[model samples]
Target: RLQRDQELTGVDVVVLDECHERHLDADTTAAFLWDVRQALRPELRLVAASATTDAEGWSRLLGGAPVVEAPGVSYPV
Candidate 1:
């Protein structure tokens, strides 16, 4: 999609929200998403957000890529 179509031409930054949704395991999805991103768009910044996942998996996928986490709101038990 990046070559035939300019899907990433004007994209300043790409935030891959809910990237883990694609995988049954959050960590597994992180690795998969990272590989997909690297294969598709290495320059575009990819971000992942989830209730049970964190930037560690993302780092592994991204080879120690930087991660900025925003504390998510939680409901009462």
Candidate 2:
């Protein structure tokens, strides 16, 4: 959508799940979203989420965005 210069109408948030996997497509999408947020939509909310992701690194990459953690649930194996 971004490459075509189409506006992200009605889209308030974007969550990149499993960011720790570091796949090329995911990385590229994140990069593009970051660019969009920076250049076009400063109000756009972007979230990079993963249970084992580097929170600090992602936060820094997202221009000092805050890191929010959800409590984990324990389950017997």
Instruction: For each candidate in turn, give its C-alpha RMSD to the true structure in angstroms.
Output: 4.6, 1.7
Candidate 2 global CA lDDT score: 0.88
The TM-score leader among the candidates is: 2
lDDT of 2 by residue, 1-77 (tens): 76676347778999999999988899899988988888888999999899998999999999999999998898999
- Candidate 1 has an lDDT of 0.60
The local distance difference test score of each candidate is 0.60, 0.88
Q: Write the per-residue lDDT of candidate 1 for residues 1-77, one digit (tens) a residue.
A: 33454445666554556665665565554455456556766776666655566568766766787776767788899
Q: Distance from true position, residue 36, model 2, in Å?
A: 0.5
| Clash-forming residue pairs, model 2 | none
